[model samples]
Target: MKNHVLRPLWVAILLVIALLVARKLYVPADFGINGRNFTYGYYRKASVNDWKEFKVKYKGRQYCKECHEENFDSISKSKHRIIQCENCHGPAIDHPDNPEALEIDRSRGLCLRCHADLPYPGSHRNDLPAIDPEEHNPDKACADCHNPHKPDLEG
Candidate 1:
């Protein structure tokens, strides 16, 4: 009876020791670096090449201003100053090398994303003018009354 229980316990201890040895051998020597934990280091080693080879898609407002000074100037002075050009227009990745006119999104839904009236109470609601699209102008697009570049509608 004693031998039967001892045999299983010995096998289990040996199995755990084997697993520990295998893990130590398989794991990298420098598996942690620069305060980053083991998992981060492991993934970084696996994907470092991909990150190094990656090209930037968004070149930022300064890059856009290089060719589009007039529009950039207009946007800088307007209520929409905080909004990025690429937010309305899609990514300008290839525009610099192979120039083409970007398609503008003039949809009412796009305008309403930030301007739509929500029942929730906050100071942001007061800062941003919101209207009921259905009642404001049932069939008309927001662009009909508002200029996207300026968007103040006060002129």
Candidate 2:
């Protein structure tokens, strides 16, 4: 009784697999029904721009703590204390001096650079899922979920 049932199931599975293979081989790239054609375009090479004039230098985090003791004090206690502020927010030499010269960069790309399959320390082994910028807040940034100063602070 078991063999009779199993034999028919195996035969049906093989038949389905054979039909799928045949369908793939016969399908053409173009439908050719409505004179539609599919084309893929490649990117063209371009000359490099001279960005030296716009480039700025970073003076490091120590320079920030001098004036921003409150912010620096909180940040120093977080896991990111090991990480430099300029690493994520860019150079603050101008921003620190004028408070508006430069802006912070808290993009999600910076978080994924280390959090994604790319390369993170063993500490991130239990990392969360990768986020889609379009689906979520494109501007809230990683700081929305995490605080550089209070690493595991509840938001």
Candidate 3:
């Protein structure tokens, strides 16, 4: 009768509400790039708007080098000069405050973090003479072989 029909309709409405709630919680609508006409998913791009929203500055090693001429000059000679400062160390925002006071991350493990094969741009070679912890003593850091601020191969 009317009771049976109403019961099924109520259940259907509840199910629809549940699905909407689940979608809102788990599914991120704006997760992809917002294109001109449409949008993009993980790999797929929108044919309309391919350009970036805003311009980004090159706030990496080169930016740091411009300010720290003396330190930059010294590090220029090192093998690590080819590598960016943020590669081994995290970011260089606070390090400039008191260069000596800041505990610059000089761990062999940090070097191995990228050299492990993650392969970000300008990453060092795996064969580039890093000491193996299992094979060698842990007392050695990258600084042991190559001086960071004043690493002159000629010296």
lDDT (Cα atoms) of all candidates against the true structure: 0.80, 0.66, 0.62
Q: 39-109 in candidate 1: lDDT tens per residue? A: 56334353666788899777788989988999999989888889888888867888767667565687888
Name the candidate that leads on lDDT.
Answer: 1
Per-residue C-alpha lDDT of model 2 across residues 33-116, encoded as one tens digit per residue:
343333533222231234435565787788878877888778777666777877866778668457766667766777766555
Top TM-score hit: 1
Off by over 4 Å in 3: 1-58, 93-103, 114-126, 149-154
Candidate 2's C-alpha runs over 4 A off are 1-56, 118-140, 153-155
Deviation (Å) of 137 in candidate 1: 1.4
| TM of each candidate vs. truth | 0.68, 0.46, 0.44
Off by over 4 Å in 1: 1-46, 98-101
Ten-residue region with minimum lDDT total, candidate 2: 40-49
